[model samples]
Target chain A: MTHQRWFTPWLLVAPAAVWLAVFSLWPSLNTVVLAFTNAKPLGGGRFTGVENFARITDDAQLGDALLNSVIYMVVCVPLLTLLPLLLAVLVQRKLPGISFFRTAFYTPVIASAVVVALIWGWVLEERGLVNGLAQQLGVLSGPLPFLTDRWLLLLSAISLTVWKGLGYYMIIYLSALGNVSRELHEAAFVDGAGPVRRFFNVTVPGVRNTMALVSVLISVSALRVFSELYVLSDGTGGPGGQDMSVVMLIQMYSRGFTGHLGYASALSLLLFAVTIGPMLLLLRLNRKAA
Target chain B: MRKGWLIPVAAAAAVLLLSGCGLGGDGGAGEDVDASGEVKGKVTFQTWALQPKFTDYVQGVIDAFEAAYPGTEVEWLDQPGDGYSDKVLSQAAGGSLPDVVNLPPDFVLPLVQQGMLLDIEGADDKLNADYVTGGIDAYRYTGHNGVYAYPWYLNTDVNYWNTELLAKYGLDPAKLPTTVDELIAQARTMKKESGGEVYLMSRKPELGDLANAGVPIMAEDGKSFVFNTPEAAAVLDKYRAAFAEGLMPRDVLTDKYAGNAELFNSGTVAWTTGGGNYITSLATDNPTLAPKVIPSPAMGTPPLYAQGLSVASGSKNLPTAMALARWVTNAENQAAFAHLVNIFPSTKASANDPFFAQSDGTPSGDAKVIAFTSLAQARMLQPVEVTGAMSDIVKQQISLAISGDASSQEALDAAVEQCDKLIGQ
Candidate 1:
């Protein structure tokens, strides 16, 4: 057996360990401490002891934000999970110009969210392409308030999130599909299973673990949605701030004279608590599978 | 002995964690300085996003200041426009604020409250007489006892109308609205004539509009808001009624509402309020639309906007910092700056400058002439205490009222209550 100095392991991990301590552990601990205070962004703070968390109960804006999160998650998880898997299956085959199609679908995933949101903002404006085309088709008498109405704005952000996320999840599904048993697929085909039957019985069960992981990722991302909603609404949080996400509330209180860093920290803790539910659920499901 | 390294690692971790929390430090406090000493030290001067465009002008001013002071040096730092408030706040908290800093009226309020800025009036008694009353009064907060900054530059809003759009919609471009009631009547006429294809108004009523209509936005002491009066509600009611009648675009209350300048550029709106340099800037964006633009005085008490240079209270070189601030804001330097841009000079003596009084027969030149004259009657319409967050609450409440979700009075009351709560906090 080789003998090494006692500090060798420590020296190797010191860089990563220090980074984690400074950026992650320290900030998380400080956030916990700050959540009990009334800290302004300019740095004067005193312990108010649950006052911020107490305000969360009566905050009508928080209530609206929670509802928006639920709607976003409920819609995103299923669409993102199944649509990406189907897209992976379609593109997994060897075909002519397949790389081009794959790249075309994956382009939005690589595009900057701000640029994408700005383009969508122009596309959904009252005089934009969508409304103009619809009106020109004699399908409507007037333009629809796609970017103005609260529900429409929320739905628009959700659509953008899903559109942008599709290629990312598709690549994950493609990697998982490669690991599935090709023999099982061929055996099911020989047994006279149709494409739909084979996909459900063979392909799905094979990638069930990857699907759970994707669902968890989608759930956390939907709960933590910021840029899609922020850029879409130009950072106003939609009409009367009714379509705000919890993360948006945190960002709202993180700067400027009106910013309360302590309250933002409390909101951050609440977000961590909310997101942990999906993660715990995934862990439970994995344990059952084990 | 096997885990000897753990002790040092744990110690370092604890130190990092404790330092990150910033235990026992009151970041808001700063030591007051006496400015009665000789001015011969290096002073750091910071401006907001004025580089590359005004580089030569600012460098020239700095060079002149150095020449006048002989041994003094001015280190210039120009910050970008985005996230400037947050940047300044962080710098103040970290005790790294520049010696001489340029800040607007609203941005000065927080620093003054924290005692981070020097009292300019206390430092120099005769300095107040150099600047215009409106310019000096902007730096005087309601609760603050002394002025905190030397007023630098002044600008006010000018109404820009698209003559071609108005003429196309059968509204006379020569006869522009001079008051809110007249503006609303023209909006109605334009709405009917254009079949709602175009809009005269493209924005919701802000605090300035309510103040222009004679609503006191705050109480005398400035501790709380009192703009929920019937007069304010009446102004909102007019907007609500006009909105219901499709006189203004539906999206104007929402985030989808780009400002009036954008809507004007697109030819969807006939009016936008901008600074004296509006026509010059507009020509760069859309040259075709610039020639057809008409400049007129704002519909109400033209809202005054001022930028000023403040001295950091904790600055070691207080004398040089204060001297540099005063020298930069002097009438000669201000007039030189005004000559480069259409912005007005804050110094009272600059009012006599012929450059501001005469028009070069261009649209922008006419705008400068009108803005210069309007500055005489202009005041800071929106109080500095109304923060961005408070403005957002007002925006949301007013949006609720305009969309028929609540009455105008209820909206104003809610806005006042929320804004007052923020102030109390």
Candidate 2:
């Protein structure tokens, strides 16, 4: 019976294990191997003893890319993780047509990026909705370049990203909000804590785990923010072309379009390091906070 | 029509029928023949972005090919021109490429450098006798003697000005700016005078445009960056000033050429640079602007073969693959396809056809005459082994300069260093 018990669990896990091994583990392992090679342009590649890594030292764009990625994370994470929590709180109340509000908030999350981009592109153009409203409101003298000025374009992109992502993180926080006991809020009320204080003292503490998880998720999303950038910039990273995230840079290099697969592989492994390292660090930081 | 440079036309597939006697003469003579002296089995032919517009015409050619050759099948696959290089690389890696594929020569360089393309030159020399020498030679990689792709059509860039916009900006349509600096100066004055209602350029002008200002991309030996001089920095400074002063739209950094076309037709910007075929688009999308559209001969250098068709390297059916390549690029078909899409046929016969010589005095008609003559002075923009990576590095530095993050001298110096490291110079 004990041996049979092992067989059933092992058999159940086998499919998933095999799936990961084939799709995820093998490619990751291959990427690490490729990182050490010259890997392209006739004869494939040979083991080159860290020449690719050495090239990174001379790469002029790495610093700008890193800076842009960090800026993207900083801009995206708080807007996604924290603002959604506040939104979830407001929409969480039992009220008439609350579901409608929730659905409206979540509609952007459900919308495809293409649709979102089209909407945003029109909304942010010189004569588009946002600028027209501004013009009518007499907030500015003339039409502003919402999608044209580099800095404004970046901000516009950030706004679009946050807008699209808000509902998803809100739903996550809403689920977390559901788990908090009503008794906790009542007890806090009895203790004379105001609504804001009660939120800080009760609901927030309860949803701390969800907050941490959402941070990591948004961080990963920010790190891989190519599609949004692609749509917003019409495929050129805006301004300095520095709007492209680190992963896009990896794709631009790796796809052998440029015949720099070995160097690209090295960059890929570097991406793996950057992505995985932060996730692990976040986990550790959360554990320590707990 | 790429607002961007990501998909430059497939560079090496020019072909001519001559007499149609022995187009693929060396087909059965090559390796991997089955001793039966026949080219057989399923052969896949892939083309880029020919759907809806050229699908029927392409199918017609395929039908003719199948009728002429018994026991042989050619399946055609088509993909859009966007992100084509990435698609080619992924396909190459997976080994899912068609037997005969079309690629712009510059875009095909990475694959060629990998030695993954078959030696087409070794198979057919006589067939290309009447083809443009530049078309045939464009695919010749630096170290390899093998010709990678056969040239097809040329898409020479031309400056299309919105004369209405030019007059609106107080600039004369008769006397256009002949150089990059002059264009920017006129643009700056126009923007300032118009109270910032007009934009001068659609995108940040790069090395190609700067080449018009006499900025060479590389030295005479083609071994290193030639933009190390004061002249180069001065040219870069002009572009940087354009962007900083809001002469060029911010969207130029990201918007595709399609987006730029929208802006141009809307009369938001004064002019754009594109193939002569752009006038046709102006005629269709914005007819009001079509009559106002004035086409100028593309300044600086041009290359032959905006699109090319080539056989895959490790095909089990090379003979069939070569046959399809030759058949599609025959003089008659090339001329017909060129007529359909304004492709410049590389064959002498196709070029000399009365079809090309005639002009109806329309803007498009004049533009065709210009696109035809533009190639006469074009020097093939040869793809060095590390073309993509080198360009990426330089583009980044130039972007930084355009954004005012770095001086032009600093930008060009960085380009030299990074390019040197990549090419091991």
Quality of candidate 2 docking, DockQ: 0.38
| Model 1 spans with C-alpha error above 4 angstroms | A1-8, A283-290, B1-32, B255-257, B358-361
Worst 10 residues of 2 chain A by lDDT: A38-47
TM-score of 1: 0.94
Error of 1 at B71 (Å): 1.3
| lDDT tens per residue, model 1, B236-266 | 9999999899998888868476677888987
Each candidate's B-chain TM-score, in sequence, is 0.93, 0.83
- Categorize the docking of model 2: acceptable
- Indicate which candidate wins on DockQ: 1
- Per-residue lDDT of candidate 2, residues A111-145 (tens digit): 89887987788787777898899989999777887
Whole-model Cα lDDT per candidate? 0.88, 0.73
Clashing residue pairs in all predictions, respectively, total: 0, 16
